[model samples]
Target: MADQLGSARRLTTLDRLAGGSKKGVYRLRLDDQTTVILYVWAADENFWPASPTVPDDPFTDASGADLFAINHAALTAAGVRVPRLLMLDRGGRYLPSDIALVEDVGEVTLEALMARDPVAAAAPLSTLGDSLRRMHTTLGSHFGKLAAISRGEAAQARCAEDVVADRALGHLDAVATRDARLADAHDRVVAHVRHLRGAVSARQVYGLVHGELGPDHVFVTPANEPALIDIEGLTYFDVEWEHAWLRLRFGDAYPALRPVDLDPHRLEFYRYAQVLSLIEGPLRIAETDFPNRQWMLDLAEWNIAKALTPL
Candidate 1:
């Protein structure tokens, strides 16, 4: 990989980073002391795939890598702070799965920054809000996976309501199959989402969104700027969803920075859809050979119960 990037310097150090289910992250230091983050998409057939809640079909390892690369470029052009895409090999030519080499943003994640000092983190969190607003402002004519746009498939564009409806229905099916007790609540949420389809579909705004913007994926630079990472699930959808996730995740920790007026109904529906979508992960892992299978099942049940409760 270093040779491909035109660097003949031998790698002096390599350390694996923690906490990614779908990708292996590593920090590599060349003999010359230059550092870069190497991201290799997970290709194990049994490792599971990209989130089904993402707009359009779930992504395979190769396709997900391509989408991540495309999304990185698009987001960078939209004035959103993200790591520089130094090199990419979406075809898995040099590794077991597709790989990307990106500029190292530093060792600090937004989560750590927040924990270290909530008072000082305020400025960066606010800046993150602004970055997210810029991302939502980057519009697309179609409402689905951003990768589809590069393929000239705008004709298959869907309305935001339709996308959310499909995701909600899928979540309900997955959750109900794993736990029968929450079936009634799942059904009610699905029906409510269906009821709002007409109103949500009529809205005209469509823009790119970081479907998963948890603090782990947000890195705080040495200069105190927020840079986004792990963008495999970027898509075009109602911006309200992004704001809702931020508000739900951060609460009063970060000031609201939505670029447009948020509709209370739309925000609520999307929030439910978001929480429901999260249930799929634990349910899937519960069926695996993971040592913590029972724990995952318990967590899944807890999430299902939480989803059923009023927000």
Candidate 2:
């Protein structure tokens, strides 16, 4: 990989960027002072336990070359800002696993920006809101993965809310067996999810949702533009699904990321489901040797309390 690029730029430094549990994220600095990010989808870098959750369908932990390629195109076409793709190496002639080189968007994440200074973070957060509007308003004919949708085939005929409800139920069951507190509230949480799920009305349109979008998944460029990363799970789903996550992660800053006219019913259901996801996903990752084990466990425990709030 370096040999090819070395001819022109001369690769000088390679540092593994923090985060990215599913793929290896590395910053490659060339001798010329330019930088690029290399995404390596290999088993060694993946922290998810083998077969963590039973077939999560549309909401699965997404990764790999095919997904990245399709989603990048979909978001780009929708006028959503993603790190510009420099090259894709699917053949694996250089690296053992699928690798992609994209323009380095930089170190500043919206999460970091929000933590460092809220006053300065306002413009970028507002810009992120605009980006969300563009992404969500760019509707799709069907609700499913971008790869599936692009091939002119819908992933399912079921309502988008149904998918969330089902996945949430699965997470609830999985976590109950592991956590005592969740086990205590298992029946009640399940009932509330079902009740809310029943109240949710079916919809025809679906938006391009960044499945696990949070402030951390968003990067702010020097010009203060919001650039989306970890986009493999980009799909056509309920915009409220994305909004629920934004609400959870951004908190007080959520007003800056909120979209207009989100269904209250779907929001209620999806938000609860989001809590379940946080619990289940973190617990699953914690099963492996993820460096943030304590943090992950704390997240699961915190959401366990949040999960029972409605009841």
Candidate 3:
């Protein structure tokens, strides 16, 4: 690590950063009183337990330095701000998997700032709104992960809406086996999704989405710049999908991330699908050796209630 940063700025200490489920994130303190972040794509650090039962999709355990680099480039091109890339190690020279060195944009997430002082956090939050606009307006001819699409590796799979519906139903079935609440609400949930899905009109063009944008994923720099992180799942899809996430995470402040033309049917349906995903995903993680089992179950329970809500 010191060799990568050159001899002048030798690494003095390393501290693991939180919220990285698919990769190892560490902060490197150098002798020069500066810091940088290192992202390791090692398999051992990943928390998502692989399943042979589930059908594959774009959002499945989205990770890797290739995805990061591609998404970073595309997002930057679209005027969305991300951490500055210092270096990327893809060769087996470092660890078995890929790694990256990026600028330390600070530890204060927009979520934290908003929690600390809602009034003062207004400026940075507004900047994030612009970032979302740029990302939403950047259209892609086809839908898929930014890396796969860039490398011409994207499959001719079903449209984004269908993918959401299929995954929602699959999760519905799986969650039923694990939780009695899902088993009882199974038919109603299916009916709600199918009804909303039917109301959604099809479209050809797709826009870039952060896929899982939350205030927690946004870091506000000292200069008041809001930079996006943990962006490996970045994809080109229906903008409504991203809006659904923003509405959930931002809650009342969702209007800041703007677009007046979102389809109501798609937004409602996707929000429910996202809730189903949250329920199933956390339970799957809790089954693993990952710590914080209680919190994961709590999240699953919260989302389960949301999924069972009347439409």
Candidate 4:
């Protein structure tokens, strides 16, 4: 595999960049003068974004990479600004099948920009809402039954169980007393969930959506085209799941959540789903990737507060 990664004719010059949990990414130049990004799969640990939620397959690392390829193809064909696929290798000796060679956008990721200026949040949040609306409108139905679209719900529930079992959830519970606002927020969220479930059926609200939506995945080019990447969390479930994830990351400052287009209930559902994703995902990632345990605990506490919320 090392030799394959280093080979210059087929794939050459892999300079490691950035990625989540288990995958290794690099900027490579193919012999065809095609500069592409390569993903090399190697997962020694599972768990991240930090909680004690074990993924469905604690050691299963290869599946999400392949799934991303499929999602990319679909999104690209639908006219979404997804990263173009240069090549795909699911897992093989000459070409490990799970990896992919994708076009590098060479632009600033929203995450980086947000880090530089978090106070000036409105512009990027609006841009994110517009991009999400485009995606949800264009390709949500093609992926699966509307209700099954958001995989985050299933993932989140499982993570909650795992956290309880592993005693990670206990960590957050311990801090609740000290953080009264966090506790109050948690209660409000729960009430919201109860109201939503009672008000509507899952079929009316579900569809395939980007299971994960955040500053990191939403990339913006100088031309203002917002390209969505990191398709690992794509799922077929409640369309609201997507909205919820976006709301959690970007908050209510989003421009499009007006009376006509946005549904707060759906956003609540998707947000809960995202909370589960973060819990299970980070708990399974390598420790080196998340050195600040306290920060992770803080995030987990926040998500947990969201997840257990009623609406």
| C-alpha root-mean-square deviation, each candidate | 3.3, 1.8, 1.6, 7.4
Candidate 1, which segments miss by more than 4 Å at Cα? 1-9, 31-33, 49-63, 91-93, 184-187, 195-201, 256-259, 289-299
lDDT of 1: 0.72
lDDT of candidate 3 over 196-242, digit per residue (tens): 78988888788888899999999999999999999999988888988
In the range 1-311, model 4's lDDT, one tens digit per residue, is 23434554575466766544446667876676656677665443223333333344221232355567667765676556777776677657444336777777765777776677665544655655555555566533223422223443333333222222233233334334445654566455445444544444333222446665677777766665567876655544445555655566665444343312555655554344346445544433324445455666566566655555543
lDDT of each: 0.72, 0.85, 0.86, 0.52
Q: Candidates ranked by lDDT, best first?
A: 3, 2, 1, 4
Instruction: Show the lowest summed lDDT stretch of 10 residues, model 4.
Output: 159-168
Instruction: Compose the digit string of candidate 2's lDDT tens values, residues 157-235.
Output: 5677777778888899999889888889888988999999999887888888898888899899988888999999888
Error of 4 at 218 (Å): 2.0
Reference-based lDDT, residue 31, model 1: 81
lDDT of 2 at 19: 86
Better of 1 and 2 by lDDT: 2
Worst 10 residues of 1 by lDDT: 54-63
Cα TM-score of candidate 1 = 0.85
